[model samples]
Target: MITRVRSELTRYLRTETVGGALLLIAAAVALIWVNSPWGASYQTMVDTSLAIPALHLDLTLADWTKDGLLAIFFFVAGLELKREFVVGELADPRRAALPIIAAVGGVVVPAAIALAVGHGAPGMDNGWAIPVATDIAFALAVLAMTGSRIPVSARVFLLSLAVVDDLLAIILIAVLFTASLSLLWLGAAVACCVAWGLAQKYRLHTPLFYIPVALICWYALHEAGIHPTLAGVALGLLTRVRKDPGERTAPATHLEHVVQPISAGFCVPLFALFASGVPLNTAVLGSLFTDRLALAIVLGLLLGKTIGIFGVSWLAIRLGVAKRPVGLEYRDMFALSVLGAIGFTVSLLVAELALADVGAETIELAKAAVLVTSMAASVLGSALLLRRGRVHQARRDADQLPQGEGSTK
Candidate 1:
């Protein structure tokens, strides 16, 4: 019975729909809990402090969820990214150019919109990055649910686009958020990364060796004033993605299979629970419109993402720089671009980090903006997807019908 239960649990964790549902449920719980009569208790729980003095580590429950647990999510992202670059859709420059260009447009346009709208606003310096990421799990979940009739290549396009989007977001985080630099700790982190790469090269497969090294590298990055989650990305990219002769699976694929469940089932939902507890009071709701920072985020997500992704993609195809995915028309690409605007996970992280130095009220407003915009994008994208899906479904049905049966009619 225990073995059976374990197998079922693993299956549930591996399902993207389940993972996405859990993420949405966690965020909803956070919102409701924070706005409840016992809202103060929610804040207290998030603020509860923990420390490891020997390691010079101290943080609140919220910090741990954001900075520590979320690393697992990023690690899984890095693994997907490496696999794609090595052997997936991104392996071919012809197939990769479209998503790569579209991902850049997705990032650049939203940031430009945010900067233009929020000029001189408090926290606008870094808060413009809030809409620059695409949540892979959530976006993929929505696609899986709504776009079943869409071509298989549409899913591949979205996946490749999201992977590149995440890579850009990670780069922005490392560049925009690091306020101080410690050379010694930075060197230590680099050394640990080198050791990790060597372990992969020499085929060291033991978790016992890797677990400690990963921890030390994470701590070193923290001490060096770089986000510790970058350690996850570095290690994931360094992992070997190619299989040896007689090997069952490549290390990257195997690791993704193992760690993805943990990241999706636990790490992301926990982080959402902690990071998404923004107060939705009347003032906060009003400020979502009145506050420049909030308005920038909303518009950046809704308008900028759509325009950037679709516009650049159209240009690319027209100019013969890239071709659209198989069986996906311009309208379908537009819907996919709207789906790209569902910027939940990394967007929330950026909201927190970008507004960290600002007051709590500002931070809450930013997070609320992210939640609101992401939901809007999801709804709008789903509508577009369902419409496009019906079109494709009808086409498929017609093609599958008996030959010339409707000609007389």
Candidate 2:
């Protein structure tokens, strides 16, 4: 019975739709709970602090979710990214260029728009980074549900684009958010990463060997004043992706399979629960439009992402710089570009980090913008995808019809 239950849980967590649904549900519950009469309890729980003197860690429940749990998500992302570069869609330079360029364009244009709109606004310097990421799980979930009739290559293109998009966002987080750096702790973190790589090379496959090293690396980074999440990415990239003869799977692949369920099922949803509890009173709602920073985030996501992704992709194909995915027309690409605007997960993190010094009210408004913009992007993207699906379905049905059956009728 225990084995069966474990099997069932793994299966559910592995489903893309289930993970996305759970994330949304968690965010919704947070919104409702925080706005209800018992809202104070929600804040109290999130604010409850736990200290680890041995590790020199003191963080609230919310900080733990953001700084600690989210690292697991990034680790999984790192594994997928390494696999893609080694063997997946991004393995070949020719096949990789389109998504890479599109990802860059997606990042740059939204940032430019944000800067243009929110110039001189408080926290605009860092807050402009908020809309540059595409949430892989959320975007893939929407695609899986609505793009059933779309060609398989479209999904591949989306996946590749998102992976590169996330890499850029992680780099930005590491570079832009570090307030101070301690070389001693940074050296310790680097040594731990090297140790992890050595373990992989030596074929040490036990979790007992890795969990402690990973924790130490995370703590080292935390003490170094770097975002500890970078430790997860480093460890992930260090994991071996190549399989030896007679091996069933590469170490990276195995780790991803083991860790993905935990990241999706628990870590991300729990983060959403704590991070998404923004107050939505009349003033806050009004402020979403009136506040320049909030307005910039919303516009950057809704307009900037679409224009950046689709516009660059179109130009790249026209100039013969990159090839479009097979079976994907410009219309389908536009839909995918719209889907790219769903920047929920990383955007929320950036909103918090960028505005940590700005004030709680500004942070709340920024998060509200992210949530609203993501919802709008999802609806718009889904509508476009469903329409495209219907068109493709009609074409497929017509092609399958008996020859001359309806001709001249």
Candidate 3:
């Protein structure tokens, strides 16, 4: 089970490794389009509405990226989480405790920082959740660039932290960002989810059979005034993660293989393209430093994420609440914490929701801050990891030296 999980994760990391580069390209294109004289055309495309009158699915292209496409992304997340809990490393309580506890610290401290900064500016406090996200693909892509001297423990630690962090972000979205609920639609979503669960119990493996089930959940959640991407989470957890006795592969394992390409290659890059494209001008550029919202976002993602993630993780170890994985050092964990601060896609999503009522100007400033801070976080993390990787490599070479021959020099 562990080997299979590792294989799946390696494949995922590879996809994200490339997807991160593509995501950057897509975001750059969007930014250029929106800032060009044809910028109005980009806005028009995002605002343009598409509807399936029969299914009652009506949304702008931008909305589809969030509600429709991101659902697939979250579904993949759900599958991996369930797999981990069932048969992967997280099945062991001791193994799971470190990342989960540390993830809590990561979420809380960043929000506290954002809250502190935002409190002085009335109406800016609602965006506390904006800094609580980690852009998994982008962060992993940066890690992938660090080369082979990086420890396996570091990969596992970062992956574990990211999973738990994302889970917290999802809860924050559900609890704080959701406006009002329609019980009828919410109940309908539950019913569809229940039916999906039963299908899993029955080991129904066909996508044709379950795709409609997923759509019903998505549609219901949309009508319930909840984010429809959550429907993916629901269905993903319901999928079987273990093969039956004598059975070959888990349904979830198979589904992940099928869905990953679609989510990584198409969904996420498309979402980044639509969501990123904030028009930059003298006024917008100037507002980043002038506005409290921008300051909150910048500080929260930069200083807050590092402090929150590393402090909590270190405290957990010191308090004996969690044990460090072998080969992982405090500084290595700190490097991972810095990478955890790359709150790109999810951070932007939260900014949109957190600033939905604040005004267009506030939204744009928050978005710009998220973009700039994510890049800054990436650079900072890379510098640390690069230094560490070289030191690690040197130590490895010295260890390979025979009979301390190099010490004579």
Candidate 2 clashes: the total is 0
**Total backbone collisions for each predicted model:** 0, 0, 0
Question: Candidate 3 on 1-409: residue-level lDDT in tens?
Answer: 9999977765764465787887788888999999999999999999999998987778889989978998998898889888877897678888888888877888898898988987767446578889988887788888878634668778777777787788788888888866889999999999998998898898777888799989989989889989888898879989999789977788998888878777887888999999988988988878778788788888988888899889988998999988887777898888889998999888888888788888877887888899988988889899999988988888888887864786776
Q: In model 3, where do residues sit more than 4 Å from their true spots?
A: 1-14, 120-125, 403-409
Residue 398 error for model 1, in Å?
0.8
Instruction: Encode model 1's per-residue lDDT on 294-376: one tens digit a residue.
Output: 99999999899999999999999999999989999999999999999999999999999999999899999999999999999
What does the lDDT come to for candidate 1?
Answer: 0.93
Error of 1 at 220 (Å): 0.7
Q: Candidate 1: where is the Cα deviation over 4 Å?
A: 404-409
Write down the TM-score of every candidate: 0.98, 0.98, 0.93
For every candidate in turn, the CA RMSD to the true structure comes to 1.6, 1.8, 4.2
Residue-level error in angstroms, candidate 3, position 328: 1.4
